[model samples]
Target: MLTLSLILLPIIAGLITLAVKGETAKTVAVVSAFAELALGAYLYSSFVPDATSQFSVSYDWIHSAGIKFSVGVDGISLILVFLTTLMVPFIILSTFGNNYKNASTLFALILFMQAALVGVFTAKDAFLFYFFFEAALIPVYFIAAIWGGENRIKVTFKFFVYTIFGSLFMLLALVYLYLLTPGTHTADISALYQAARVLDVETQSYLFGAFFIAFAIKMPLFPFHTWQPDTYEEAPTAGTMLLSGIMLKMGVYGLIRFVLPIVPLGVDKWGFVAIILSVTGIVYGSIIAIQQKDMKRLIAYSSFAHVGLMSAGIFSRNIDGIQGALIQMLAHGINVVGLFFIVEIIQQRTQSRELSRLGGITQSTPNLTVYFIILMLGSVALPLTNGFVGEFLLLKGVYEYNVWIGAVAGLTIILGAVYMLRMVQKSMFGVTSGITEGFADLTFNEKIVLFPLSFLVIALGVAPNIFLKVTEPAVSQLLSIIK
Candidate 1:
């Protein structure tokens, strides 16, 4: 029931939002988002810190095809569930300062996307996971295409094409696995794992490629990352938050859930290739971010870089590596969303995302400056900030895997500090520019949005164990399975 409510609340509220008008829709969305958060809190309270799935519920969906509507929570899924529920209200609230056209539909789509994200995280059936996986794209695609900037149509089309193209590979992989199941041919998560385990190393390697392609494109890991910056730049801030903060996690989640244990031999064979690509992306994205004059686009590349480390850590396939990836997912989601909102606030006030055109915001908006610096420090992995523990563990894991790659991967920290602080120096300091001379501080509503995020940055940093304890058992279990 807890799992069901987590998925259903957003869905039901989305339907309600569609029928409401004007401010009512926003009200409904905010209420719904908070309600989801409450459920997430209860879920955390109820969930035991162990590897076993809890609150599981399954119903026959396609009886003839052997698919069931199965959903549950474990430590790994719970953290992400928490992230989705925790972030949605803030994402919605962040938009309060603007008056978008057809506001009802926009909020409705956010709620719907939330529902799909929850579904993806909790799903325990292979086909059900795939169903929710693809279902999530619809609302976000509409969110970006309809409400985004001047080039939204072109940029979103490429995004749509890249994701849909990648998803086909995932579907193909799932379908192939389904046929390999014994007896009744179920697509249960465990059954898929069992079937996959019997395959030859060569076959598993092929499966690895199929699954990796789908997830890589979603994480938009290096070579596959072309669509990301443009889409982030063109999408509405809410849409960008959803994409960067929550939606992209689906890919990382898929890598951990579907790829690792199910295809261990495959991973052993081809995982190094993934590690190389991910490390390359780390350096590649950070360098590109340093060159970006547009704040949103810069953060987009930053996100791309951060996810590369997460991917590399997971592929490292050690306890530290995978555990680090899990905690980092939560930290990255929080920090990135806050960063994008900071960008949104600046853009909203100054009508520009260009670093060259903005300056001296700190003179007027001390509160905004403080929050921005906190989130920025978190992004650069300052000690005792949210980003620190995860990156440390990730680098440790990568080092255990290979010294040279770990050395290269560590560049993200230095490069991140350079670009992010540069952004701060150029945008927040210096003499007030003509455009930013009268820039105002955070509005009451904007404060409401950023305050929690700012608090979380320090809190997660100070006591990451609150989160790490829950995921450790699950990570151990996964490592055992893969081994």
Candidate 2:
């Protein structure tokens, strides 16, 4: 029941919010998010580290077709659930002062998004996972289409079409796997995992490719990443944060939890090709980010760069690489949320996100600049910041797998710093632009949003062991399965 609440609370809240009016709706949304967060923390506190699948709740949903409404978490899913619950409240609070006309609708959509994402992480059956996986897209599409900037229709459609096309392949792969199950079998992920492992090598490779393509497109790696920049640039800031900070990690998580484990031999066979593409994305994304003039687009490209490294780390097929990828996923989620929120603050004050048109924000908004710098440092992987720990671990993991691959991919650190610092230098320092000369410092509410994020960035950097300890045992279990 507790496990079910983790998925149901937001959904229930969303329905209630849909009926509320004005500021009351926002209040309802925040309260619901807080309640959800409290529940997540409780779950985290009680979680048994060594338990194979903790806090599970299962019920027969479509037993005729061998599907069940099963949901549970191991260490990996638990941490992600906590992250999602923790962040959604902030996402809601961040909207506290905005003047979107359809505040209730927006809050409702965010809550809906929260529900679907929780479902994605908790789902134990492959069919249930696919249902939630596709369901997560609808709220985000509404967010972009309804609350986005001009040109949103085109961007959201492109985003929709690109991801859905890839997802079709995944659906096909799932159906194929379902067919392979022994008589009167199930879509329980564990069952599928066992079934997938016994399949012939050729079959495994084909299925792996299908799953990989779906996840990769969601991760928006390299050539498939074209939809991201426009989508990020045009979507509302809260929407962008949700997409970059939390949603993108879903793809990486899928790769770790679904693609790699179920198709270990396939991954071992085609892992190098994946690594090459990831490294290329890292280099390509960074170079393009350096040339971007729109701050949102720059961050979008940076997202691609970070996820590239994450994907590469996962494909390295070592404990360090996979563990680092997990850490990086959490760190990236928090840091990117902060970064995009900073972009939001800038846009709110200056009515623009253009780098060339904005400058010298520090002259009037020193406090905002300070927070921006910290987030920038986090994005650049500065030491003693959350970003540093994950990137360091990822590189170390990759180096252990292959020194050359590590060296090539590690250039993202330097390039990331170059572009991020340049963004800070150009926008926060130097002469005050006409547009930004009168900019205001962060409001009290904005401070509420940013301070915790900044503190976490540094705290996690200094004490990543806190998270690593929780995740390591489960990651080890995964690696043991593959071995």
Best by TM-score: 1
Instruction: List the lowest-lDDT window of 10 residues for candidate 2.
Output: 46-55
Give lDDT: candidate 2, residue 472.
Answer: 81
RMSD list, candidates in order: 0.7, 1.0
lDDT tens readout by residue for model 1, 1-483: 889988898889999999999989989999989999999999998889999999999999999889999999999899999999999999999899899999999999999999999999999999999999999999999999999999999999999999999999989999999999987799999999999977999999889999999999999898999999999999999999999999999999999999998999999999999999999999999999999999999999999999999999999999899888988989999999999999988988889989999889999888999999999999999999999989999999999999999999999989999999999999999988889988999888989988999999999999999999999999899888999
lDDT of 2 at 116: 89
Count of clashing residue pairs in every prediction: 0, 0
lDDT of 2 by residue, 35-125 (tens): 9999999998888777388888999999799999999988888778888998899888888768988789999999999998999988999
Q: What TM value does model 1 have?
A: 0.99
TM-score: model 2 vs. ground truth: 0.98
- TM-scores, one per candidate: 0.99, 0.98
Worst 10 residues of 1 by lDDT: 344-353
